[model samples]
Target: EGMDVVSFASSAGPNNQQVITEQQLSTLFSNVEEILEANQKFLLSLRQLGFEWTNNPQHLGEAIKKHIPPLKKSYMTYATNFYHAQVFLLSLLEETKPGPLMSYITRWEKEVIKIDMSPLLSYLILP
Candidate 1:
């Protein structure tokens, strides 16, 4: 009986942790103005060509054919950071208690269901 109680208590810790972390994430995501602003900035940066726009595709291709390096280094850096943030958020969710986490999920699901987000969903799943 003592061993059973200890195991139950240990299991309860992870559930509590997951709930707290999920609440934290939900609160963080709740500010729509800031989220929209950051998203707009990210899209604007992607659309900007900088110096690369001036290059002729055929000529640039031929010139760098033998010694080409990867492009979009900055974009890749940002993508890596974004992926890390998602993973961190998920980890926090897993660490939070189940009850509060469930409540957050319920709220978030309602908000998400109300949004018309085909474009945003595509971007979220992009490589």
Candidate 2:
């Protein structure tokens, strides 16, 4: 809690010196993690079904029944909470060109978060 706002916004110009709070960052990661964890469980359920699910159409419903609702909820939560993170990221991107924060965000984009939710949302939203 002994954070220095000056150091946090050191690279930013006077007009672009809005520092991202720790809570905002935590919200971003927590939302993303919830989606990832929910998807992982859904994938695991599908994998567990394996050949039997492919062979029997009925098994597909049972395999996904428990996983889908929670996955959908997690995605909805992520979608709702992502705006703050997007603003934070954009601010950082604007301030930290050719710097460590830019590289860190780039690495995080490629490796930590490779999520594309359009297709998943279509499936989740369609009854």
Candidate 3:
């Protein structure tokens, strides 16, 4: 995608060309929605597991370790979807008239980073 964008940009003259169309925008939006839905599902699954273990740490730790593979898989899936969404959004920003994308970029830049639990859970479960 980056190579395609670079080739397109190089071929163009001084003035910017409208490379993105309404159809492309629609498709990107749909892709973003799908990514969001998947993220929500992953988060919901994690929350459910957390809730289930709230009363019993030992049992919860065991369950988490037993389920590590699925949790890691889901986390990786979510991360990939998130990266795709970011790329799509960045492409849209460069190809279309700017609007809220800048705000989103700003907000994202300001957001704090936290530890991911997929790897952390194993250490946490160790006695």
Off by over 4 Å in 2: 1-21, 96-103, 106-127
Runs off by more than 4 Å, candidate 3: 1-57, 81-83, 97-127
Clashes of each: 10, 0, 0
lDDT of 3 by residue, 34-63 (tens): 444455565665677776666777766765
Overall lDDT per candidate, in order of appearance: 0.42, 0.56, 0.45
Candidate topping lDDT: 2
| Local accuracy of candidate 2 as per-residue lDDT tens digits, 1-127 | 2122224433453457443445754543435556667777888888888889668978889867888899889777766766655665566656734455455445544543447524211322212
How well does candidate 1 score on lDDT at residue 90?
Answer: 60
Candidate 2: residue 44 Cα off by (Å): 1.2
Arranged by TM-score with the best first, the candidates are 2, 3, 1
lDDT of 1 by residue, 1-127 (tens): 2122113322334435533344444332322333444555554544553456467455444434422222244334445555554554466456655464445544554666678534322333333
Candidate 2 pairs with clashing backbones: none
- Tell how far residue 16 is off in model 3, in angstroms: 29
